[model samples]
Target: MKRNKYLILILLTWSLFPFCWQVYTSFSVSESILNPISQIESRWTLDNYIQVLTANPPFWRYLLNSTIVGTLSTVLTILLAIPASYAIARLKSFSKNTIKILLLTASLFPYVLLFLSLLEIARKLDLGNNLVALSIPYAALSMPLAILLLSSAFQDLPLNLEEAAIIEGLDLWQRIRLILIPLISPTLASTGIIIFLFSWNEYPIALTWISKSELITLPVAIARIAGSSVYSVPYGAYAAATVLGALPLILIVLLFQRQIISGLTQGAIKG
Candidate 1:
């Protein structure tokens, strides 16, 4: 038990060390970055954050773009997944395992493999540089995992409850709206959060699809900030922007952590 505890502690430190260093760097004066010990002695300032916020492209605009894309993608994924999951969970038309495998295989195909084709399709469809356009691919990419999770949650629910609702004169949509959804709410939240994170952090897709400054999402904007060669790279500002970019996700997990945990672990026990 002691060994396990020590191992966990070591792993925790290893995972958090880089973030801690970034936080330190965000506040440290530029000259202090090379000398770790001098970080404590150097004057700290909010100038990094200010610079990031006031940059030509504007940090808040990138944040807004991320929010729009992530929220829309998650909503679309959930809407599409719910019926598909219910059909898979309750229907006996085909082997559930086979269907699940096919869905997983589809999702496992690397996004990079589809990149060029998707970009061409986007241009042909006049979706290039459109925020809503980004959501389509994001939703498609995340659909499989969302469907899998929702199917598991739906399967875990008692069939008798659904049958009872049917006997009470509730139609299919009514039963799903009032019965199954409430029971699987936790799983839905977990799935939505995961999809949102995927969309929010996606860079390669955004980088390829969006060329206009106004449409750029946070990840792509941050990458551009870090890669700027026109001016000396502002390490402090870059670290601060990274922290800002990550803060929303951190707060979201902290807020819904219990639901996320419960949703993921719901079927682990067989009793």
Candidate 2:
């Protein structure tokens, strides 16, 4: 038990060390950030954050772009997954296992493998430098996991409720909207958050797809800030940007931590 406790402590410290360093660097002056051993107390300032937030390109715009893309992609993923997962969970016509396997296989392919094909398709569709274009692939990429999660959540639900709703003249949509959804709300929230994070942090795909400055997402924007000039890298500003980029996700998890944990555990264990 003591060994396990020590192991947990070590792992926790390892995971948190980088984030702690980032927070420290964000508050420290540029010189302190460059020299890690420098005493932060004498060199601390908010200039890095101020500069990052109020730069000419504007940090808020990047945040907005990320919010839009992540939100739309998550909504799209849920919209597509709900119907498909419901059919797989409740319908008798389809082979659930086979469908699940196919979805998993589709997701298993690395995005790198599909990057060129996606780029070609995006160009052919005239979707260059567009958030909707970014969202298209993001939605598709996140759909498989969303479907699997929703399917498991749906399957865990008692079929009797669905049958009762049906007998009461509730159509398919009504049954789903009124019965299944309410019962599986936690899972839906969990799935949405996961999809949002996937879109929020995606860099390679966004880098290839978004060429315009205005269309750049937070992750891409942050990367650009870190390497904005050929001569110098702004370590202090980079740290601040990294912290700001991660703040929203941290707040979200804190707000819905209970639901997220319960939903994931239930989905995994029940099905």
Off-target runs (Cα >4 Å) in candidate 2 are 1-8, 38-41, 91-94, 226-231, 264-271
Q: For model 1, what is the error of residue 150's alpha carbon versus the real structure, in angstroms, after optimal superposition?
A: 1.1
lDDT of 2 by residue, 152-254 (tens): 7898789899789888999999999988898888899888999999999999889988999888999888888744587788888889999999998898889
Clashes of 1: 0
TM-score of 2: 0.89
Error of 1 at 214 (Å): 1.7
Candidate 1 residue-wise lDDT, 50-138, digit = tens: 88888877898999999999999999999999999999998674688888888889878788888899989998898988999899999
TM-score of each: 0.91, 0.89
**Superposing all C-alpha atoms, what RMSD in Å does each candidate have to the true structure?**
2.3, 2.6
TM-score winner among the candidates?
1
Cα RMSD of predicted structure 2: 2.6
